[model samples]
Target chain A: MRVLGVDPGLTRCGLGVIDAPAARTLTLIDVSVATSSADADAPDRLLAIADAIDAAILKHRPDAVAVERVFAQHNVRTVMGTGQVSGLVMVAARRAGLPVVLYTPSEVKAAVTGSGRADKAQVAYMVAKLLGLDEPPKPADAADALAIAITHALKGGGRTAASGASATPAQQRWVEAERAARRRN
Target chain B: MRVLGVDPGLTRCGLGVIDAPAARTLTLIDVSVATSSADADAPDRLLAIADAIDAAILKHRPDAVAVERVFAQHNVRTVMGTGQVSGLVMVAARRAGLPVVLYTPSEVKAAVTGSGRADKAQVAYMVAKLLGLDEPPKPADAADALAIAITHALKGGGRTAASGASATPAQQRWVEAERAARRRN
Candidate 1:
């Protein structure tokens, strides 16, 4: 299954696409960011984001779309922007006939790193190893988007058992992924 | 000029259309609410809202769109939903080549009822009086939407001085509107 993951934001939204053939295999298909200037009007910025996501959906034709859920934060303006982008992406995904799922930051971290409290560096490192990339994806947002996609592909695709340190191949993949993350860190 | 006012929400977004021939003259063209079920998936709910707003824009073809600017609140989920709807309406309005403006709740209240701290009843009463309607619009959401349109027409349409009690004809309109509100209360 090909999954598109979106880390929604107004200034810089991250997009990542990955194909998972089996529980133990993952391949990175594409990664990019959608950006809008802060000086532009709110409507124009929103349109720029919507158009970029629409293009990504058309280009990748992912089987499923996963979006990072916006959480309550101190900055109301930032939270508002995040929520708006999330809504736009979700609607666009549904319009394209793709099922949409939302994952919280902890959910993504637990799924990918076997710990809900994993830091950004650890998550990015795991993402690189999981996708067999030479280096971690840059700009943190791109790595986050890829992590969300990997989490959904592993969990939603119904190919992996519940996560743990057990010797199951899924667990083993995570262990290796974690080890790679440690090495890179 | 025709103005479309949107009170944004995820479950029930209120829409109001009004014709502003002059700063003092206004007519209500339409008032309604767009609803979505909480049981529906997020994407589907978002789509329902988008579709409803899109249809309103196509049907009304307003010259300007006014959306209630989302404010910080304790309810994160509610704020997120409201922000999403606001973004969708603004983008759709721009796509239709209409100018979009955002009014704070206090601004709408002051414009309609002569007090930024006016309660819902006061705003509703003024909305009914301003539109010369025999009865107040049902469903507070619809009434708020109408109030928003009236505020934009009174302010953005260049009828009133900057929100004060000077006895311009615009101020006179406010005095009458406020008197009407007090009578209803």
Candidate 2:
């Protein structure tokens, strides 16, 4: 399954594409950040981000799009921007006839680092290790985008059971963590 | 000048169009509310609202678009949706090559009823009187939308000077209130 993940924001939106070749194997297809000027009007900034997302969807042709869900509890200042960008992302995916799945930050962390409360560094390290990259993707947002994609690829839409049988030791841990998170929920 | 004003929301978005003829005289061109089901996904909801605004713009061919500014300070639960829809409105206006303007609720109220803190009823009453309608538009949203359009027509984007000389007694009060509001700002 090929998945496109987005960490939505008005100033800077992170995007990652990955291909799950096998149940336990993953390949990094693309990663980039889309940014807009702070000086621009809100609509223009959103339009720019929308264009970038649409371009990614056209280029990658991912089976599904994964996005970080915006919560009203935190980031009081940027929550609106995050929500607006998330809206644009969902619309772009839907327009392309692809399903969109949203994951919370904690869910992405647990999927990548085996801990819902994992810090940024730990999540970044795990993302780099899982994708077989020499280092974690830069600017944090990129890694986060990949982490969201990884979460969907591993356990999105309640499809976790299919990959359980072929899991390696590390994949087994993620599966266990996901199960725990589900139970907690 | 013809202005399309939007009071954006995810559940029900209010839209009003008006033509400013002979400085102070106003004509109501159109008023309608676009709605989306709460059961639909956020992206789909936004797209539906976007389509409505686009259709209005295409049909009215308004010279400018005006929208209520979404503030993070209020409506914590629905702020995100409001912001997202507002973004969509601005994008549609920009896409149609129409200038977009934003007015605060207080500004709209002040422009219509000569008081920034005026209640909804007062604003609605003044909207009907200004537009020479038999009664105020139904669904407070409709009235608010027209009020916003009236605000733009009366004093938007630092264009308050032109209409000042020919102001009637009521128009004079609105102009004075607007100046006071600007001074306070």
Candidate 3:
């Protein structure tokens, strides 16, 4: 199964693709996206984000999309930012006929690094190591995007043990694939 | 001008305080509210979030808070998560002494990154680089939180910017301290 992980933004939205095989190993495919404008009023900007999401869907052809869900942001303005990106991503996925799996920051952290309170550097480091990469992924956002995908791959009904630290080889392959894709991006 | 940004989450919430001094330099301070089953019931969770917001206000104190206005996500369950988080955060701000500054995601991206189509990472990177941070803040969620505060600093005036980035840091310190003293658990 192929999974696409996305980190949406206006200037640089990150996309990571991974092929999840049955052995728990992730087959890294590719990761890339544009950083446009994420302003609320710019319909053109929203279109760009939609286009980016569609492009990823068409290129990766992932069966599922693992997106980071936004909790309430203390600022209404910031939450609006979360909602706008989320809305565009959701629309693009729906249009592409892919299901979206939402993951909380903590859940993704725990799934990838065994700690919910893990920092971005830790999450990035774990993502690289999990995929057998020599260095942590750059553009930290992309690494996170990949982690979201890996976490879902581990949690999706295809898992062996269904919890932290027990992914099968196929699951492992999917995670590895995500890291490989990051470098290519 | 001082702007406060908040990323509200049921489990882990983020808070950021930024002083956009007129001297072309920025001072940024951020924090997080870590909760784990601390709220026994739905209401309790709401209150916990509210209290967290209050705590943020007391700690970072800003003339205005830029929050992302809440939107109903695709799934009802997800929408509930967004709404509850927003409600508590907003309530806390009102209960404190600050006026709320709301913006849509696109607006924030446009205001911060000069585009409405940017993703969270793009925004965060620009936010960090623009504010002079060597690296982007962790957990996209916290980055979003910082975005909210920066939004207020940039917009010029919604409620108080009319008073200036209300441009001094002393007022910010006072408001933050008051909120801290009145903190409720």
lDDT (tens digit, per residue) of candidate 3 on B131-179: 7899988877778877777776665534322221222355456555655
Off by over 4 Å in 2: A157-185, B156-185
TM-score of each: 0.84, 0.83, 0.44
The two-chain DockQ for each candidate, comma-separated, is: 0.30, 0.28, 0.02
Docking model 1 quality class:
acceptable
lDDT of candidate 1 over B58-154, digit per residue (tens) = 9989887888988656567588788888888877887787767788899899999999999998899999999999988989999999998888789
Summed backbone clashes in each candidate are 0, 0, 70
Ranking by TM-score: 1, 2, 3
How do these models rank on DockQ, best leading? Answer: 1, 2, 3
- Residue lDDT tens for model 3, A1-185: 78888775545667888877742787667867666543323333444665677788887788877777665533444554454565456545655655565677898999999999999999989888777778877787789888988887776523222221234465567556765777899
Total backbone clashes of candidate 3, pairs 3 or more residues apart or in separate chains: 70
Candidate 3 CAPRI classification by DockQ: incorrect
lDDT of 1: 0.83
lDDT of 1 by residue, A132-177 (tens): 9999999898999999999987774422212210133443576567
Better of 1 and 2 by DockQ: 1
